[model samples]
Target chain A: MKPTFRASMAWLHTWSGLVIGWLLLAITLAGTLSVFRPEISSWMRPELHGRLTDADTATQAAIGWLTAHAAHAPAWYLEAPSPRTPFTYAVWEDGTSYAQHALDPKTGAPDVLRDTLGGEFFFRFHFELQLPYPWGRLIAAVAALALVLILLTGIVAHKRIFLDFFTFRPGKGQRSWLDAHNLLGVVALPFHLMIAFTGAITLANMIMPWGLTTLYKQDFSALTHDFSPATIEREASGKPGSLTAFGPLLADVRHHFAPNGLARITVTNPSDSNAVITFNAIPSVSGVGVENHTLSYDGITGKLLAEHRETRPVMGFYRFLYGLHVAYFAPYVTRWLYFLSGLSLAALICTGLQLWTSKRCHRQQGLGFKLVERLNIGMMMGTPTAFAGYFIANRVLPPFLANRAQMEVRAVFCIWAAILLFAMVRRPNAAWRETLAISSLTCLIISLIGGIPHSPIEWAVSLVSLGIAVLMRYAMRYTPYRKKQS
Target chain B: MLLPLSFIGLLAVCLLAAATPRQASELFTPPLPHKQQILIRAFGFLLLAASFFVGSLSHNAGRLLIAHIGLLGLYAAIISLGCTLCLHNKKRRDPAKRRNNHT
Candidate 1:
């Protein structure tokens, strides 16, 4: 077979990656952090620092917290804490609304929790970019497809793939960068491919639920009933009843399901004749957000009523995929491995772009190179600048401000956009150095501010940032370029 | 034969690496043609060292340490070999260039 198709693919890969390298970098980095998000969030909140609670205590607290928070609600949802976390979060639907709150780790009492808007915001942005409903997801999905093509072409373009596997010569400017890119890309091929494909699949229902939509056309009720369970009608009962004895139902759930990493519990149609307490098992796999079972309990008598367990072959397959992708239930070794590899993938994308632009320094000091330079400016430094801004907003913004979380994101984008504009006007070499220094300094200062009430860890991180800034300044000043010999 | 295949391939990559003079034409410009051997070896070493920390944390220190260190050493050796090839190739190519241009 003529390698022309491969050559075209190579071209496609190069251009495709160059086109969306920044976006992919952001996604990969954020996704890597997302694996340890809960842990990071816990550390950020100094209030939750020393207190460690058992599962039973946390669970009880969750139950009480949900009941109090959603007293007048028709249904309640409790997200139980795992071994890693000390507190459980509870949410419930009231009249045309849903409210959520954290439960105390020690007593299962309703506790005001430290805001984790930063962690959650970053996590969501990784996947959805926090754009309007489906738009962010759609853009991300397209980027992921582009990424797959890039990887395939990249592999093919490097004819001596295995030969170049261990090649890395320092002081050889662009050559070293290429080696880094190839090494990372090849070594973590499985991870890179899986992350992109699975990330796309995460939004599959939104993108191509055509089969589900078509097969279950307009018979939405019947369709849901076919796979899941038919919703039984429940009439409200005026008599007040004690929800004290939910223990037996909980026991029943554990016994039947083998304690399936249950994250949340929901009691629907409360105060009704057919009040059903559905204990949803935490999602294990690709359905990271979706739960597996719906174990119903007679809300009044506390008796196990019905169960809709998704243990079938088809459901199991999805669960496995989701489980693998999330890496939550996986052993610690696997999760950390995934995190390191994901970081490498992010580094690969950035190094690849840097290598591309650096190689063409003299060839095209023209419009095209200028455009790439601006993009590199925006991508390479803009992201970290935006991230620093996000941290800044978290510390400076008034807690009572309306939609403060969203504002943090806006701050990030605003800073990122500003840097991109600066890159357009500034010289490429100057821009690279200035932006890195600025980003590092910004991160350092913002982290200091955020760390004031927190701990030394944030300050330590700031020192590292400042150190990076200084190092970048040195490199930018010292690194020399050879004049072209035509 | 395998060693020679590996050696030749590594040398080709190293020559390709050595050719990136920062002023090279875009058409023949090496992709990500920056420091080829040293950086790869450094990163490979760091990754292996990092795995040691991770392995120790997870109590899989013995097995993982051996595996990671072995892999790191192998890559480091290859990178060292690549460096030698790069130097040798540069010597050969530079002399040929001087002769052709009569410089």
Candidate 2:
């Protein structure tokens, strides 16, 4: 590319990266943490650790609980305990919405664990940006699209990327920042591309609803049917028939689907004679763990009704993308890699933002320059502090408080807001130092108070906090964001 | 164990590739010879490619391979950042000490 063309591309890359870098950091960090959703859930509910049982046993327990409580309900849902997540949950229709509870595997009683969103909050925020439905997702999709453009522009802009790959100049202010940005962007080029594209693909339907209409010939019901699990329906015979012991039926299904296990069970008209139960098989960890591959049976007679396994040619591709987005199929080792990649994303953005700020440090003292710097400090440092705060709130919050689960979520956002407000008032460099220090202290407190070295994850998180503190200290010592008057 | 082994091996390969020097210099550090750098990088790439094939035979199949590929890149970036940061801190202080002696 010509120098002029490359410089234009550079302008695009820099501007694009800076415009919404804060939001991207938040989204990416939340996303990366969500990879360990089940593990976090396990940590949050300490009571569920190591108490998981076989799918058949948990299914039976869930069935027994639902039978007693919601016999008259139209439908019942059971999530059998899996190897990954250790809770069996049952849900029944309550008025218009659903009432749900996680059941202890051993006794099948309602789980005494404190109510929390656990890993799911991060998952939702990844695409939703924590805003109400549609708008948050729409903005996320737009951001994903912009990220793809920025990546392309960045590649076009960096003419000597090969040389830059081999270079890292430490103490040279702007040069160091540029080299760091190029290094991070180039190293994870493939991951950055794949994550951006697959992320956009995830909201394919919402992005272009007309495309689904075209595929399904405007039959929304048909589209839903094609995507939904297989089911069998039976009319009520006006005779009440008790639910058969779910354990044997579940065992038989497990044996039939051995190696691949059960994920969910849905019982329709549980007290009626014509009741039907559907068993959905769980895909392997490295496979797309969607609620497909269903085996239906008569609730009254325990007779096998029908079965449908996922076998479509297109499904493999869809599952691949789904699996990539969810990281559902990864082993723990690979999962940590995803988490590290996420932290790198945060680092990448941090370096880019710092580079932008450093470039102007010697010349400009505009409101815009200060505004962007404040945002970077607010989000990059503030978000981590908020995450640590979330864990601490989970630990300290009383279980009996009204809507305590909501309160825990509120604590996370409240801290996030508080940090941003604090960032606005303080000097940007000091804000970076202070917020990172706070994050480090918060993480240390959580680790020690929760009994550090007790669990590998807890220890790992604590170390990350300490690492951030040390990193920020080095950053403060070497960079352009010193307290000199402009 | 196979997955982690392959993962660590891949990261080691990335670090080895990144160790090749960037600029030509006389004093402290010199770029590795071209022949050795190319040979080492080729070997690293081959091993990284081999992991996918071996992973399919392992229980997890192809899923672990793709994740490892992304992770290897991340590890490379972190290592690069760490090396540069260490240099920045050391060089920054060393120059200050030398200048102080002269002054």
Best by TM-score: 2
TM-score of each: 0.73, 0.86
Q: Candidate 1: lDDT of A263? A: 66
Per-residue error for A463 in candidate 1, Å, reads 9.9
Residue A135 CA displacement from its true place in model 1, Å = 1.8
Chain B TM, per prediction: 0.46, 0.60
Per-residue lDDT value at A439 in model 2:
77
lDDT of 2: 0.74
- Candidate 2: lDDT of A441? 77
Q: How close is candidate 1 to the true structure, as a TM-score?
A: 0.73
Docking quality of model 2: it rates as acceptable
Which whole-number lDDT from 0 to 100 does residue A29 have in model 1? 71
Which residue runs of candidate 1 sit more than 4 Å off their true CA positions?
Answer: A1-3, A50-52, A93-100, A106-111, A219-244, A255-260, A271-273, A282-294, A395-403, A442-486, B1-103
